[model samples]
Target chain A: SAVISQKPSRDICQRGTSLTIQCQVDSQVTMMFWYRQQPGQSLTLIATANQGSEATYESGFVIDKFPISRPNLTFSTLTVSNMSPEDSSIYLCSVEGQGAEQYFGPGTRLTVT
Target chain B: GESVGLHLPTLSVQEGDNSIINCAYSNSASDYFIWYKQESGKGPQFIIDIRSNMDKRQGQRVTVLLNKTVKHLSLQIAATQPGDSAVYFCAEIVLTGGGNKLTFGTGTQLKVEL
Candidate 1:
């Protein structure tokens, strides 16, 4: 199990503003992922943040909207750029460990007004 | 190109009773599957997983059953407690195209009443 933490656990932002969320893991992990969970919806994979490499965004999501940076093995950041009311959701960071099971951070809840 | 889905949107059960949540996947090539529990205002927690080669796997008070023929998966919880109330999700990992990429399904909210 990994102890994962996210900054700005909950926040309210104005539309057109951007918010960058930070994710930290207790130890080095091979793969880090970002996910979005809309209210009353399932989790959607936003991208995979690989250390020292460009993150891979999933379909319907792009770097321009959800840019990601993986500075090191234990830390990463996801920036919700040009935010809109539809972008309001819970963002989570996760890491896959030894047994191939993924552990998730506490998640950042963002509300755009 | 791939999607995982659940059969029910909500499930209600009494305390001390058993609860089962079902999921279905579209990709037969997926070899790995995982179940997750997400409480309100918290990240999802891994519950248990089963491989395509196995039909069933058990964890502490929980069991996962896989039916590859029908591309169906189910999670069973025994002696449900009030604290066990949460949204449950099932995910499938296609080891071929991407490296350990997980596709999550629509969640099932389980309500355990005392």
Candidate 2:
């Protein structure tokens, strides 16, 4: 099993502000991803964090709103910029394990007020 | 767009009884199907996974059954416990240009009654 950790387990941000959540894994991993879960909703993939390259965003997500940086195999950061009340959600980070299975870190709960 | 979906939004089961959660996926090209458990305020935890070639796979007390004919999947947990109470999601992975994109279902909230 992979031991994944995230910084700033939660935060309350004012509108137009930004928050950056960090993710760290115990060992090197091949793939890292970011996800969002709106209140009372299921998780949605935001982007795929690539090592030494810009992250790949999903169709509904954009880099400007949610910028991602994965400098190495074990660490990454997701910044939610210019936040609004609609941006209030739990942000999660996950690493791909063997056979396409993913292990997730404890999510960062963000509330934009 | 490919999508994975669940039949029921929530399921209630008695402790020690078996619990079954069902899912339906649209993409036939998916490489893997997986089950995940998410507790409140926590990220999803991998429960079990089955490959496309296999019809069923078991882990610990959990059994995952995949029916490609109907594009359906089901997870069976024997002797369900209170600890099993959480939101369950079934996801399908399709290898894309970026990586393995896991499309998740709406999820089923499992409530174990003691």
**Highest lDDT among the candidates is held by which one?**
2
Residue A50, candidate 2: C-alpha displacement in angstroms: 1.1
Classify candidate 2 by CAPRI docking class.
acceptable
Per residue, candidate 2 scores C-alpha lDDT tens digits across A32-95 of: 9999988777789999988988888989999899999899899999999999999998899998
| Model 2 regions lying over 4 Å from their true place | B1-8
Q: Write the per-residue lDDT of candidate 1 for residues B1-114, one digit (tens) a residue.
A: 111123338799999999999999889998899999988778999999888999999999999999999999999999999999888999998774334788998889898888
Model 1 agreement with the true structure over A7-30: per-residue lDDT tens digits: 999899999999999999999986
lDDT of 2 at A36: 93
Q: Which pairs in model 2 have colliding backbones?
A: none
Give one clash count per candidate, in the order shown.
0, 0
List DockQ, one per candidate, in order.
0.46, 0.48
